[model samples]
Target: MRAIIIDDEPHCISSLKYDINLFCPEVEVIDACHNGHEGISSIKKNDPDLVFLDIEMPAMNGLQMLDQLGGNIPFQLVFTTAYDKFAAQAFRLSAVDYLLKPIDTHDLMDAVSRVKLRLNRDVSRQFDNLKYNFGRPFAEQRVAFPHRDGYDFVNVKDIAYCRADGAYTTVTMADGKSTLLSKSLGEVTEMLPVKLFERIHHSTLVNIQFITQFIKRDGGYVVMGDGVKLAVSRSKKDRILSLLGLERW
Candidate 1:
């Protein structure tokens, strides 16, 4: 894929270019721009297949440049940001991928691979969903997870619990449906709102609202509305009790 690298930092541009050439030989660097304006011009001029854009740039930011595109972007975008604050925004924009800097070689390759796969798919819906979410309150926001053929988007309140399955997570919904995610429990936990989801076990994260009853059996366990019993680790018992507003036995 023909691509452009846009970043204000010289070393970052150099490093990404070197990494792309060494690791992702499938992606060709067509142009490297120092700021967003140059990135826009390069993209329009070259009509590249992909673009590696930086979020924080002077004169015009990456999002600003994208906004100028009038939502009919022809090429895929992969955002590079040093700070994690922009990750949510990148996801909101339906970016093909997000690379945290100093970008790892494996991550860079993985991002490129995802970009290639998504190139054939329509990503405009995700962008529209994100735009809708931005206007809603945080509690009304939704989270998307990669499922069987595509992705499953669920409201935070609809999730009953999440269980760790080694490197993957099984998300159980209140309606009794479950979906396996390709992300680890730890990784997925970070994406969830802390106030709504609580870790009752090392491998389990439960939505506080779905707890039907807390049974003091096998040390301690919580019963979900769907009747799934989940054990509470001894270390987490007190914390869970505190969250439940119950007295510790």
Candidate 2:
């Protein structure tokens, strides 16, 4: 598979390259970039099958750069970082794989094998979904809920709605508690299973199961089981109504 390496640290990139060549012999390293800007350009230019990305870099961090790219990320990503503790939950939520720095040859091989399997099987489906929603709108793309102290879970189901709090999306759960997830609402909505969740408004995703009542207002609103009122955008009202089997009303 063709691949690109993106990291500010030259040694980190070099080590990864060596490991890929030595252990992951099937992976071809087409290019490498020093920062997020260069990484974006390289990805757009090469359109490689995979990307080895670093989380912290100059100008734009990995997550921000991914956001800027909108969707259709062009390749599968295996994030390489020294700090894995903070991002483990986020990675799990997105269902993306990652490798910790001071790289392990065995773990690298495992990650590469997983990538190859995905490419051979499910990559097309994932790519199509991401491409279809590239930059047209903003929706919750992922979630990170506190797990055990410092860890978190994506919890796509428990999320009833998400509100934009500047750069963060406040994910409101069915239980009435809220947590700040690091992705935008638009991105989250696109990444999530569309049949299961609908973006009723710019800031909300009302879980069809948790919706207790639908109130007709300026546009529409849903009263979730937990009694939280969430607004439904005019454009999405029909879809939400249809999903809830309330279209006849």
Query: Largest lDDT belongs to which candidate?
Result: 1
Give the Å error, residue 238, model 1: 2.5
Q: Assess candidate 1 and give its lDDT.
A: 0.81
Off by over 4 Å in 1: 85-96, 129-140, 163-170, 174-187, 225-228
lDDT of 2 by residue, 1-249 (tens): 999999999999899999889898899999999999998888888989998888778789776777777755646778776764533434544456667778889989999988886673333233332323333222334433322233344446667766776666777777788777666777655545554577777767656778888999756788888887888877887887788887644
Write down the RMSD of all candidates, one decimal each: 3.6, 14.7
* Model 1: colliding residue pairs: none
Question: lDDT of each structure?
Answer: 0.81, 0.70
The best candidate by TM-score is 1
- Report the lDDT tens digits of candidate 1 across residue range 126-237: 5555555554554677776766666666787788899999999999999999888888999788777777899999999999999989999888999999999999999998
